[model samples]
Target: MQSEKLYSDLKPLLLSLAYHTLGSVTDAEDIVQEVFLTWEEKPPQQVRDVKSYLCRSVHNRCVDFIRSSSRKREAYVGTWLPEPVNTDKFQKNDPLAEMVWKESLSTAGLLLLQQLSATERIVFLLHEVFRYRFDEIAEIVDKSTANCRQIFHRAKKGIGPLPDRNPEIIEKKAAFAERFAEALTTGNIGLLIELLSSDTVLYTDGGGKVKAALRPIKGSEKIIRYFIGIKDEIPAGTRYETSEINGMPGIRLVVGEMIFAVITFHYLRDQLSDLFVVMNPDKLSHFNRMK
Candidate 1:
């Protein structure tokens, strides 16, 4: 009973850690279940640091899972993207948890993680997202603390620096988002084109499970054409509702009771620079309740 209670108490931490490491809630839950099963079979007689033990166990399991799953993931057609997370469902008290949620929820951050090697991704998440000490993460990844720090530094350098935003720019992003949605829904391609910069780019990730652009659509004219074309392709009765995604205003597509997609807008100054449309059903699970 005591052991069962302990497992229950650690469940959230385990889930959060695994999810950050694996980028998939389903896989994270599976790893947590495996941990509980292992504990049941061979109970720990003494755990001086229960949290550390569980963290290490979960990290090891994630590494193994990543290694084994890489081949299958590489074969995935179209642009493979990380699963999207809904921030409203997660606990907000812990600073680390909040940061993890923010970083993981952002489309750009998630895309960057997908570009990293497994080791680099894990190191980056632990150090940058979770703020884990180098000494502690070294044990998790079986590296010297200095080596771990170097790995993290290299990873950070590879990803480049984040864009600086001012309050005025943020306000402009919101305003543009509202206007862009109205333009899209009303099929006002000219308005949309005007709002977008000349060098605007759009990326759509459907994971090849659904129909989406295989590559990014570049140029304002081409992007306008693509959005205009989508009006007819969407099923009848489908509706779009605007909402905040990763702290930016975006739209969600719903078909009856089911949420079919999410679109996030990236702004450069007052003009729309990049648009991301995520249409993969698996990726849309987080938006299930949004409708």
Candidate 2:
């Protein structure tokens, strides 16, 4: 009974930890189920700290999953993107909820994490986001505290400084996105170009299964022209709508009953700096929640 109760209590934490590390809710739940199965099969006789043991188990499983998944992802047809999350499903006041949302939803942060090794990602997340000390993470990863600290430092350098997150600035960016989307759908290329920064960049991920720019479009004129060229090419039944995505305003493309794509806006003050469109059918699954 005691062991069952402990496992029950640890389930949510384990899920959050796995989800953040692997960036897939489906994979995270699978890891947690496997952890509990292992605990039941071989109950430890003298476990000193149940929380620590559970955390270590979940982290190890996530690391292994990432290693195997990375190879499969390499064979994926086109740009591999992180899975989108549904923030409304979790309680707003929960710290673990906030961490899951931030790590999974932050476009720049998620991209940065992709560059780190599995162990480095875990070490960096545990130390930076959860405020876990190097000693604790060292124990979890089976490395020296000094080595863990070095790993965390390397991860930090890879991510660099994140953009500012002031609410007012975010609102202004969202407003600009709304206007930009309107311009695109309405065939106003001049207005769209005026809204973009001189060095604006656009990235589209269609997974090679759909038509997309083979390379990123750079500079204001090129990006604007690309949007103009594609605006009328949208399928006959598709529609576009703007909404808040990853804390900033963006656009979602709906085809019939399904959400087929999401485009996130990155702004430099009031000018559009970058536009990221995720059209990979797999990554857009969560967008269905909006309906």
> Cα-based RMSD of the predictions, in order?
3.4, 3.3
lDDT of 2 by residue, 1-291 (tens): 476787666776677667667766578778899888888899789877777787898888987888788778787665555555544344354555554445333555666787788788788877876678999888888999999999999988997755565778767776787787778777787788779888988878887867787577899888877876787778777777776565456777788888877887666766888778888776666557545
Model 2 gets an lDDT of 0.73
TM-score, cand. 2 vs. native:
0.82
> Each prediction's Cα lDDT score?
0.74, 0.73
Which regions of candidate 1 deviate over 4 angstroms?
1-13, 91-100, 103-105, 161-172, 246-248, 289-291
| Pairs in clash, predicted candidate 1 | none
Error of 2 at 233 (Å): 3.2
The best candidate in terms of TM-score: 1
| Model 1 worst lDDT run, 10 consecutive residues | 88-97
